[model samples]
Target: MKKFHRDASTLVLTLISVLLLTVSALICLKALGPHGEPMPSVTDWISAVGQAVGALLTGGALIYAARTYSKQRQDRHEELEQKRQEQAGKIIVRVKHGLPDDRTSVSLTNPTNLPIFKMNLYTIDDDGQVIEGQPLSEEVVVGDYPGHAYTQRYRVHSAYAVFTDSGGVAWIRTSKGTLFE
Candidate 1:
């Protein structure tokens, strides 16, 4: 839809420029007589108008090119951001129940090829209290499974994992599997 709008506007601008050029050409022709005689001061005015039209066309072309370059750059940036988000989403947080000692286990799985740093995993109870919390200073590599991080036997309502991805973007993942930066 945006591309359609841009093309429409560009077409309109081109049409307007063509109309202006045609009008100027007709005016210059009218300034000349049937015997090919020039009118006083009319030739100079026509030359100035021609120069102005050329400048207008050049400026328009430059503006169009700049806009195209800017749009392409923006598209590339968006594509890179989407790829980063997919990589971050690969970090999964799961809460396992029914341990041998009746304690809930909070497991973090990083399946991506890159590692995550400054990891903090927290298990929250029904009353929004933190049941167990584990903070890892070192980076968690790919396929590094930190299983049974929560040692408490409390009933966990949800779990949260906060860490920085390989791209240096911080993300928060919940037990419900929602991820965001």
Candidate 2:
């Protein structure tokens, strides 16, 4: 001990010994960390952080792409629907005329008159039950008319008719079906 204290290398040697003791204590404490210490492993912690960042970026990109695609598809669908409606006659209103002569009834044709859905007319009156009528002049007219296909696409929601030289127009036609039912 006297040689150590008096030696020229005394300070250097003491410092080396102290460093060695500190390193050994650190090793023991680290080795004991797994026994309920919850000390995270370096490799596992690094990988978990990387995966979370990757997942967040990927999810955000997917959501953006889905919304963009949906909006594009909706715009295209609306354009096509409008074009189709232009070629078809859109019904706005219909009025029926009660003729004194049952056979002499005439319909004032509206360019926007929608083609009928079913063959039945909805109203009845005192003079006679308003008979079921179709817009087509005749079965032959339906087959030969260039506009027959255009006529079939739309449906009328409601109408009123009066007996006269001419019948009234159709109202509120839509290619879209009633959503309520």
Candidate 3:
């Protein structure tokens, strides 16, 4: 795994270096002489460098866009695996109808001896729309998780736990703790 990361990083760095060299060459070619038929000025070099930087940025953007397709596929795969794991029964607790906007608390457990990132619970409304933080009053965190991506830390739970006093109001008493509105 370490070797894979090292190789990926090296490949990225090499690609970036090649991109920089190509952009620099193009900039130099375009700015061979001064503009407006006058000898090149100090500003010309600056402009050339700026153009090269712009080209580099454009190339990076293109690369990122190209990678997005693969990223989406990987994300879907991870999500499926997570759902299957959840179905297999992860230690989780929930507190429903605890805020004004029907806010709920869904606590998840990482029992696979691994810590996950971007672990957010998605709830669907009755109208079939994803409720964002529009009616959220304030977000609070009662705990933190500091485990590695592949390490289990039950004590350090609540990976991305957030509490926003939404529209629905209620009280909850879980085996872990009690949350009130």
* Number of the top-ranking candidate, with lDDT as the measure: 1
Q: What CA RMSD would you report for each candidate?
A: 7.2, 25.8, 18.7
Off by over 4 Å in 3: 1-24, 34-39, 63-71, 84-181
Segments of candidate 1 deviating more than 4 angstroms: 1-53, 99-103, 136-138, 149-152
Rank by TM-score, highest first.
1, 2, 3
Error of 1 at 129 (Å): 1.1
Summarize candidate 1's per-residue lDDT along 119-140 as a digit string, tens digits.
Answer: 8777778788876444433456
- Predicted structure 1, TM vs. truth: 0.65
Looking at model 2, how many pairs of residues clash? 16
* Predicted structure with the largest TM-score when compared to the true one: 1
- Tens digits of per-residue lDDT, candidate 3, 16-113, equal 75677696777676795746676777888788877778777766775665466456756787887565444223323342334344334434443443
Query: What TM-score does each of the candidates earn?
Result: 0.65, 0.31, 0.29
lDDT of 2 by residue, 110-179 (tens): 3433333322223222333433443333221111122221121123233332211112222223223111
Model 2: what TM-score?
0.31
Q: Which ten residues in a row have the lowest lDDT in candidate 3?
A: 147-156
